[model samples]
Target: MSRRGYARADRPGRPATASAGSAPNTVYPARRSARACEGAAVGADIVIIGAGFAGAATAFHLARLGRTDVLIIEREASAGVHSSGRNAAIIREHADDAAEQALLHAGANVLRRGELAAFDRRGLFIVGPGQDEAARYCPRASGRGTWHPDDGTIDVSGLLGRYLEGQRVLYGVTVLDWTHGAHGLTVRTTEGDVDCRLLVNAAGPWAGEVGKLPLTPYNRHLMVSTPMPWVDGRWPVIWDGYRHFYFRPESGGLLFSCCDETPGRPGVYEEDPKILDTLQQRIETLQPALGAIAIRTTWVGQRTFAPDRRFVIGFDPRDERVFHVAGLGGHGVTASYAIGLRAAEIITGKLDGRDDPFGAGRLF
Candidate 1:
C-alpha cells in the first residue's frame, strides 16, 4: 500500500486518545465504577456503537418507531466520517440472491421514492463490452442489460443526517469496553460511560471485534476525477459489467470505483497504486471518450462481511440483549434503510419475516 494524503476515517482499530465535548480531543471525565451503572434506570434504553450508515439508519428507524432515547456513540469526530461518506457510487440491485434481493426490495420501498428528498434518480446502466459478471445486481438481457430506472443514489451523509433527526449521537466517543449482563449493558467509552437496556452493534468493519461477531474487513478504494465540463449529469451511472468498474456524475465531475477488495484488518488504509492503475486501465479500455479525465482525489474504506457475505441482523444467539446490524459489504448504501428497519423489528420484537437469514446464530 502506498501512502497518500486523504481522509474519511471509519473503521475502529486506532487508539482512542482524544477528549470529549465540542472541542476536538476534549476528553470527558470517566465515570466512577458505581456511577457508571447509575443512570436513568437501564441507561439510555439503547446504546448503538458505530455511527456509520448502519448505525445511523438503525437509529433513524428506531426513532421512527418511537424509541428516541437511543445513544449513538461514534469513534470518529462525526458520523459517516469513514465508509458512509467515502462511498458515493451507490445503487440498489433487485437482481441478486434471495436475501439481497429481499433487502433491495425492502430498501427501495424505504428509500427509492416518497419523502427522501435527497434521492437522486439518475438510474444505473450496466454496459457490457465483456461479460455481465455483476449480473447478481443486474442480470443481462439480450446483448446487454437494460437500464435499471428503479436504482438510484442517496447522499449518504445527508441520509445519515436525516436518520439522526431526534436521535442523540455522541461524536468523538470511542467505546473502550462494555459489560452485557442481566441488569443491562454498560459501555465504557474514551469520552465517558453510559448504560443501556439494549446494545446494537452497527460498528461496520469492527463489529466482530467490538461485539464478538465473526466478521472480516475488506478494504476498497474509490477515485474522483477532475471536473469534465462536457460530462452530462443526466447520463445514468455506467458500469463495466466485467471489470467491476463503475462511474457516476459528481458535481460536474465523476466518481469512479474498481473492484479492489483487499482483505485487511480494521484500521486506516494507505492508498494503493495498483487499484488506481486498475481504474486507469478501465477508462482507457472502455470509456475511451473520457480519456482526458484525470483523477483529482482518492481514498480507501472498508466493507465488512459475514462468512456467507450476508448482513447479520438479529439478536446475538448468545445474548438476547445484544443485537446486530453489520456485515453489509458493498450492499450497504443501497440496503441500509431496509437493514435498519429489520434491525428495528428485531429490537422491538415485531419482526414480520424470518430473521434466520442474517441471524448471528449462523456464524456458529
Candidate 2:
C-alpha cells in the first residue's frame, strides 16, 4: 500500500518569497534551490490526472510501449480509493453496444490470456436465481465449467495488484488546472506544476471539473454480510436479474449489492441503510431461506457517465493533444485495460481514430 512518495502539499517550482527590500521584478535564480525549477517549463511526454484503474492502466501501457517520463496525479491518499476500489471487481462480457462489448471482450482476453504481468483469469461466472437472467448472459459463458461445477468469483485484489506492482504512481496529489499551448501543455497540481506534450483527462467523476469536457455522475451501492459459512458453497457471481442486486462469496460469507443507480454528488459515500434494507427484502423475495443474513459492512461510490452511457475515449474533438478516458459508468473496472490500451494507442499514433463506440464525439 505504500506509494513512491509522501503526500505532503509542497509546490515544486514556486520561488520562495524574496527578501523585504528585494526588487519586485528580480528574477529568482533556479540553481539556488534543492530542486531546481529550470526545467519546469519542459512538460512530460504524457500527464495523466487520475490514478485509478484507467490512469494506472494507461501508465502501464505507456511504459510497455517504452514511453516513460509519464506522470500520474491522484487526489486520494492512495490509488483505487474511488470507483476503482469500490467496484464489485466483476470482469463482465459484452452487455452493451457492439463497440463497447467488443472492447470489453478484448480487454477481458488481455487480462486472462495476455503475457502482461498485471492480469490473471481465475474464471468468472454469472448466475441467476431463475432461468431468465441466466439465459441473458449465457452466450458469454466460458466453457471451462458451469456455475454448479465451479464457483464464479474473480480474484479482484489479485487483478489490481498485478497491474500496480513496481509502477510509478503519485498518490494524494490533486490537479488544480491545465492549459494547452502551441508548444505543449501545462498542468498545475497541489504539489507543483507539470509540463507535458500530451494530456489525458481520466479523472473519473471529477473529469469535468478539470477541463471544459462534460461528465455526469451516477451512484451505486454494495453490502457485505457477517461471517456465515452456509452460502459459501461454489458461489457463482449471482446477478438478480437487471435489478441492481448481485451477490458473491467472500471470507466465509456473502457480499450483496442492490445495483441501485441514483443521481448524487461524485465522491466516496456511506451506504444507505434504507437501500440495504430494500436490497435485503428483494433478496428474500428471490430466496426466502437466506432472509436473516446479518450485515457487516456497507458503502457506496459514484459511477460517472457521459450523455450516452457508453465510454468516451480519445482526444477532445476540438483539441487532439488533450485526450479523454472517462464516463465509464459502472463498467470502468471491467473495461479498464481496454480503455487504457486504446487511449495509449491513440496517443502514440498506432491507431487511426477512436475505434470504440464510446468515443468522445458522441457528446458533441
Best candidate, TM-score:
1
Q: At residue 175, what lDDT does model 1 achieve?
A: 75
**Per-model tally of clashing residue pairs:** 6, 5
Q: Candidate 1: which stretches are off by over 4 Å?
A: 1-42, 128-143, 352-355
Q: List the residue pairs that clash in candidate 1.
A: 19-25, 19-26, 19-27, 20-26, 20-27, 43-195
Instruction: Encode model 1's per-residue lDDT on 58-113: one tens digit a residue.
Output: 98888888887787777776566566656764666854479778887888767777
Best of the candidates, lDDT: 1
| Tens-place lDDT digits, model 2, residues 100-159 | 888777776666554443333333444434344332233322222224322233444344
RMSD of each: 8.7, 11.0
| Per-residue lDDT of 143 in model 2 | 22
User: Which regions of candidate 2 deviate over 4 angstroms?
Assistant: 1-42, 114-152, 268-270, 354-356
